[model samples]
Target: MSTQTSRLSPEKVWLGITPTLWWNDDFINIDIGIPFEQCISEMALAGYVGCSVGHKYPTDRKTLKAALDLRGLRVSEPWVSTYFTIAAMRKQTIQKVRQQLAFLQEMEGGSEDPRKADLVVAEFGHAVNPLPVALFPNCPNLTDGQWDQLLDGLHDIGRIAKEEGRRLCYHPHLGTGVMAAEAIDRLMENTETSLVHLLLDTGHLAAAGVDPLAVTKRYASRIKHIHLKDIRADVVARIHADGLSFESAIEAGIFTVPGDGSITTFPQILTELAEVGFAGWLVIEAEQAPAKANPLQYAKMARAYLRETLGW
Candidate 1:
């Protein structure tokens, strides 16, 4: 038996890949034509057993499950945006979160498989995608009051998700206000450990010039979900130099599958995860132009690397 299939006791881990590498969910114009079946089929072909929700995915529970069932895949997590800073957005945020939880809780691949966690990134709103990176000069920072609201809102949502038997994990993104090491430290400091958990994405952490290994060591216990996208330092430098838009950075190949990027700390990060008995999906979530980086090829590369490094 392989560690990827069966690991040490008490930790239930699975490998998954997001569909963004095949089709751009945020920027529809990039890979508008990739079929959902082709993307997921390739994922299973690459030896992945789980997948995160993508824009092109079917929403009907039975339909999606039947499709994934045919390919032996299950949903790991789906991206949800919670705009907690704006007071006026509270009602809307809760309503949106409820809808997400309602649907995700019903999502099941097989009767034998365990339930996966729900993921949310504390972001402003949908209309803010492809944000102009140069405007912030660094990155957006939440006001003190907004920080309070954000933490409280996460608790509220976390309570709701718990009631529904799902765990909520927060993702710190590159274009969001929570883009720095200090910012993440502040979030971990202020937010309740149980109510609000972290969804650490190594690509985003490295892109923000923060060491993923250090962050992993600091918050290993709080993490319930993981994203293993690799990033290139030279491309990150170019983004800062050109003040490029978030969309441009992705299209310019700032992110890639693990073992193909400049970041070389995954072995330590995985060790830390194991040390803490971290359990859940370790998803590959690199957003690259499909024309340049074939998603299937990169998927194979990612799986091969993990297999070699983790002996899975």
Candidate 2:
């Protein structure tokens, strides 16, 4: 009997990181005011080929393209906060999707590469991540009606994504409606596979008390993008014990780059992804205070660790 083998190749799976290393989207006080040029240049300096959009990224396509092309980096995906559960915000959410797709397409500059950028989306209708409230035992649960709204809105955006040659990858985020494993199950079971796919975030899953490897196994086919993050177990324990808010947890140094934290299932996760023939971006998205963690330093650390782990 003959069998085909699948592995993660440097050529196929690109390594990238979000600028969250330099700045925090949820808590701007964590930012160090790193200029856009330095932020992206350091990404390339760290041996990354791509990055997601950040708050500091210019909104102009030409300007953004010029800066990134200079560093040999490209945009991987951009996070979109979709208010699908809110009836009044639905139109605005779809508009945001369309705008982001247009921006992403223009960023490619009509490249012939078949790979399209992903839309990292999550429901933010009642998210507490931006608030000072506790994350656990505080995030609101979606009602049956809200679930229907969210799923229906996801399908709508998914179709839009397909039409635009992009993929809608739903990100199950902490302090959101779909943070829990059960909520993720509902999302996977209810959404149309063709329209909606998963953006697997390791840190978020781990922080929510869900096994990231189990999530990878169960939703292997549906997962189209990845956020390779690690978490500080000590900080997580404090959060649970003190009912710390999501923003507070982040400020308290709950998240870190892989190989720098307590999560030990990454090797198995990578092996499972390889076995499943997953070929895409593995983005290091450790949300930390830039001043304390040192963005470029941690970026280089993550790059070194990944090189060691993957033998690239």
Which numbered prediction scores highest in lDDT against the true structure?
Answer: 2
Provide TM-scores for the models. 0.93, 0.96
Return the top candidate by TM-score: 2
lDDT of 2: 0.89
Please provide, for model 1 over 45-134, each residue's C-alpha lDDT reduced to its tens digit, 9 standing for 90 to 100.
999888988889987888988898899888888667888886589898889888887677677522456746565556663323366555
How displaced is residue 301 in candidate 1, in Å?
Answer: 0.3
Q: lDDT for every model? A: 0.81, 0.89
Q: Kindly report which residue stretches of model 1 are placed more than 4 angstroms away from their true locations once superposed.
A: 1-11, 109-112, 125-129, 133-138
Residue pairs with backbone overlap in model 2: none
Alpha-carbon deviation at 307 in model 2, angstroms? 0.8
Question: Lowest-scoring 10 consecutive residues by lDDT in candidate 2?
Answer: 1-10
Candidate 2 residue 166 Cα shift, in angstroms, is 0.6
